[model samples]
Target: YGGIFTPTEAAGVGVMAMLAIAITQGALNWTQLKDSLLQTADTSAMIFAIILGSEVFDAFLARSQLPMKAAEWVSATGLPPFGVMALLMLFYILLGAVMDELAMILLTLPVFFPIVAALDFGLPPEETAIWFGILVLIVVGIGLTCPPIGLNVFVVSAIARDVPITAIYRGVLPFVAADIMRLALVTAFPVIALLLVRLLD
Candidate 1:
């Protein structure tokens, strides 16, 4: 009946499938179902609250025109394109410390993309977009694992309450270091990201 399976529909289908399998195995009971539902509801509520808070904060930032002003200042610096990109990466790391990853990206992309597009990156617009996107994703992924507000770390800590949050943060440091190295490699060699795109083309 539907032309495409939306995410909500897909999630509903998955739940139904799991319920059917559990019933066939006689593994599910009313108590378990109730517990699962309660957990799901709690998780969903937390996620929604975070998203709502981020959206409101993002709107405030936008109204202040901070991103656009920052972009303008960067452009006026007379720095090379690579220098500009490096500065933006640093800014993203700081922003990610306080902002949700999705909210940060949606908030900054409009201001940053125009500056990037105007620079002489020597690649076609589409290729540049892909390369920039991968770089941004890498930086954001690092942010989600880094200190002070690593969203991934917090989520893990919440689930594994027996494990100290400090321990979890310590365990994640090596991976975060590796991510920084990978980000540097990709920034130096755009081909690392575009190789598959080129191959498919």
Candidate 2:
């Protein structure tokens, strides 16, 4: 039963539990409650806006057949399988810079997955998917923390208010370096990602 609840539902339940506790303790007055509700509404609105924008952008990409064209081009390239995968990783990094991570994954995977699936990566298709998914996750994480549009950096700056955005970007460099190192290792060694999956089986 617990497994049936989505993350959003779980978060909602948590919020309600906290609210109830606060009320019981008389720690949350009407003013505080109203302010909290207002902030929640604003945050919800921003999330919905992002979702709407992503859907619209995805629709546009689908209509243009960009993914299909890209896959075709990649297939036509004489590069070895690993070379092509490297190119795809680079593409993901660029895409992540401009798009939400979830949006980027949802928009690109339909096309990218098929291309990768056709490649001979010395692993089964399922394992290839797992490995590629992890690689993309790392690349996107790097994008989120990297400069020139690092979403997480801007978000932190926004929240901290006093911390300069440039300083935030500077601080994020070490984490991005670590992410790059991790990405390289995962790309070079599929077993790192497959170990847990194999254990489960």
Candidate 3:
């Protein structure tokens, strides 16, 4: 690979290149550009709002030492490693019903990360962290597609006003099922998550 740009910088360069191409092809008109800018602003505002809310919640939890207490309590319970992991996954599924993925992860990582890291997963510390992260993302994806309070469903419903929310939820059932299967595989065999990292190394 050329050392001209870091990965992050490459993303910016790619965006610039796309913009140049669009402009050269007369595909980027003033009205479309204005709409794109407006949409980007709206999305950025929403993301920052989520981050702000999660950070405030995280700060409160830190001040209360709740995560530490919870970790201590879990350790004292004498549950097997897999048993505790199961409970945490269940908790995430329930919590994800109400919170977005980012908020769920940020607010709970303080408590959950330590507990998982302390467990003997037959892998190195870094590998365990990576495996747990993949599992968390899978569960969060499942939660986002579940009925009732699924944040992504709500977002899509807002965009496609003509479609019933129930229909959208139904459409996503296969995806959720697939994610659950992926979660099960990753949970049972951490290697699936770490193989690429190992290969790269």
- Candidate 3 RMSD to the correct structure: 4.3
Count of backbone clashes for each model?
A: 0, 0, 0
Measured on C-alpha atoms, candidate 1 has an lDDT of 0.84
Candidate 1 Cα misplacement greater than 4 A, ranges: 1-15
Positional deviation of residue 183's Cα in model 1 after best superposition, in angstroms: 1.3
Q: Estimate the TM-score of every prediction.
A: 0.83, 0.80, 0.68
Task: Provide the lowest-lDDT 10-residue window in model 2.
Answer: 46-55
Q: Could you tell me the lDDT of residue 62 within candidate 2?
A: 69
lDDT of 1 by residue, 1-201 (tens): 364678889889889999989978989988998998898788667656765665787788778977778778888999998899988888888777667887788888988998888887788899999999999999998887789777777777756769998999999999989999999889878899999999999
List residue ranges in candidate 2 displaced over 4 A: 1-4, 43-60, 153-158
- The deviation in Å at residue 188 for candidate 3 is 0.6
Q: Return the top candidate by TM-score.
A: 1
1 or 3: which has the higher TM-score?
1
Query: Model 2, range 35-117, lDDT digits (tens) per residue?
Result: 98997777666656655665676678768877678777887888988999988887777666656788778778888888888
Per-residue alpha-carbon lDDT of candidate 3 for residues 1-201, written as tens digits (9 for 90 to 100): 488999989888998999889989999998998998897777666656654654675567557876466657777889998888877777677656666777677767877898899899788999889889888988888886776666677677655668997899998888877877887787888889899999997
Clash count in backbone of candidate 2: 0
Q: What ranking emerges by lDDT with the best candidate at the front?
A: 1, 2, 3
Displacement of the residue 177 alpha carbon in candidate 1, Å: 1.7
